[model samples]
Target: MTEKQREEAEWESINVLLTTHGLKPLCLVKRTDLKDLIIFDKQSSQRMRQNLTTLVEETSRQQSMIQELIETNQQLKKELQLEKCRVVDQEQRANDLEQILESVKSKVSELEDESLNRVCQQQNKIKDLQKEHTALQAKCQYYKKKRLEQEETIAFLQKDIYRLKKEEEERIVTQNRVFSYLCKRVPHTVLDRQLLCLIDYYESKIRKLHKQRYD
Candidate 1:
């Protein structure tokens, strides 16, 4: 049964016992017997008072236990809230990490594109240099052939000068006439122009080759 119902039944049983016993003065033949009865009634009333006090104390203890239980429940609820907050914070951190990862991925993609473009430019520059090197090789060959022809011409001019000197000496010509005739016959201007042209051509070729090599 409920606590209230059980308590009420106990009270009723106690009242019925007290009623059956009847609170009456005892009649006896001696004053000592009457005093003994008084003492017995007083002891019974004292015992009842002690029992009521004990019951009040037990009730107070139960109230204290209930209050403590309520406080503990409140503390537990606070802890649960804190745990929930921690969970939410962790979730937010995870989202932030995801966003950061996405940003890094985007930056990596951009760098990859830029790197590819740079590689293409470098390849094109290399191709152009290769073509320039081939052209320079052809030009060097042409200039080498021309230089050989110029050397042969120079040798022929020297031989002609030697023959002219021998003829002049054999004929015993005047030095002034010989010098004037040699000056008139020699193509000094043409030789100077050819030498200067070759110098210019080689200089140009060297500069172009250097540019292509560096490029």
Candidate 2:
């Protein structure tokens, strides 16, 4: 057997012997030694001391394990507190984002309303412009019709004026021919004088008619 196993076997044997003798195990102290244990039953006391040493080593190991567990628990608690703080920060950020989104939505709604109103106003303006354009088109058509009528009247008047000018020219030509025939046919002095007087009167009348026609 191993040394530690042999020591445990010896301690077990000593524990049995002490129990059979109705002896209770003694409390161990830090200063206990084999020399001090020599006052007791030798073999049993040595085994008891060895067992107490093993027990103290085991208790130290247990205390070390308990300390490790306490440190681990504290670390876990610290981490949990940090995680809780992060959660609270995230919640606050989420609430802030929600409020910002709500404000953005409100602003967007107002913008949409303004845009709708602008669109309506623009549409109304377009309709008014269309109405004005239509009125202008009517006025333009009326003016075109009046201009056409004036052109037609001017054309008719021009044709009438041309016909009257032609007639006046023909009458002037016939009167000139008649005056030539009268001058050639009439040769008596007194009769010629009377004819010249009649011719002069007729020329004055023609001149007045020409003046009236030109004016």
Candidate 3:
């Protein structure tokens, strides 16, 4: 065959092979450009699928991180509530201690007042006792002086009684001597002696009268 005819026969063979596989006939466009376009489409589809897979994986990781953060927030809120309750308990204890201290202070004040009153009363009692003691001492001294004076007067009176008794005994002895003389001389010298005796008796009477005046 000629060169053009051989070329047509090869094309006919290509067309027959495409028809047998139920493929469409090639268009008028260049084969190389067509092949390049198909390759580009396949590459674009593969890159899109890879990008979608990466995005899904990243989204799932972000969802897990968010869940963990939510759990941590709830735990922090619970701890805060417990701390508030503890503070309230401490405040109540402080209030109770303050009330007890106030009661003790009131008791101390009452005791101090009572002690002051007792001291004042004791001081007044001491003053009154001191005055009474002074009066008693003066009274005792007066009684002691009065007793000394009475003792002196009694001693003087005893001496006077002893002297008066001695005088009376002397007077009795003289009267006894005069009576004996009169009885013995009565018969013999009656007249003259009797007259002399009478005269003597009258003189004795006069002496007795003079002694009485001096006493």
- What overall lDDT goes with each candidate model? 0.68, 0.76, 0.65
Q: Specify the highest-lDDT model's number.
A: 2
The runs of at least 3 residues in candidate 2 whose Cα sits more than 4 Å from the true structure, single-residue gaps closed, are: 1-54, 183-215
Give a tens-digit lDDT track for model 1, residues 1-215: 75544654565676566456543222222234343232225655665666566667867998998899999999999999999999999999999999999999999999999999999999999999999999999999999999999999999989999987875564333333343464554234766456545545655577589999999
**Off by more than 4 A, model 1:** 1-62, 164-215
Error at 197, model 2, angstroms:
13
Candidate 3 accuracy as lDDT: 0.65
Candidate order (TM-score):
2, 1, 3
lDDT of 2 by residue, 91-196 (tens): 9999999999999999999999999999999999999999999999999999999999999999999999999898677765655566678666533477666665
Among all candidates shown, the one with the greatest TM-score: 2
Model 3: how far residue 213 lies from native, Å:
9.2
lDDT of 3 at 27: 26
Q: Is candidate 2 or candidate 3 better by lDDT?
A: 2
In angstroms, how far off is 47's CA in candidate 1? 11
Q: Candidate 3, 45: how far from true, in Å?
A: 13
Error of 3 at 42 (Å): 14
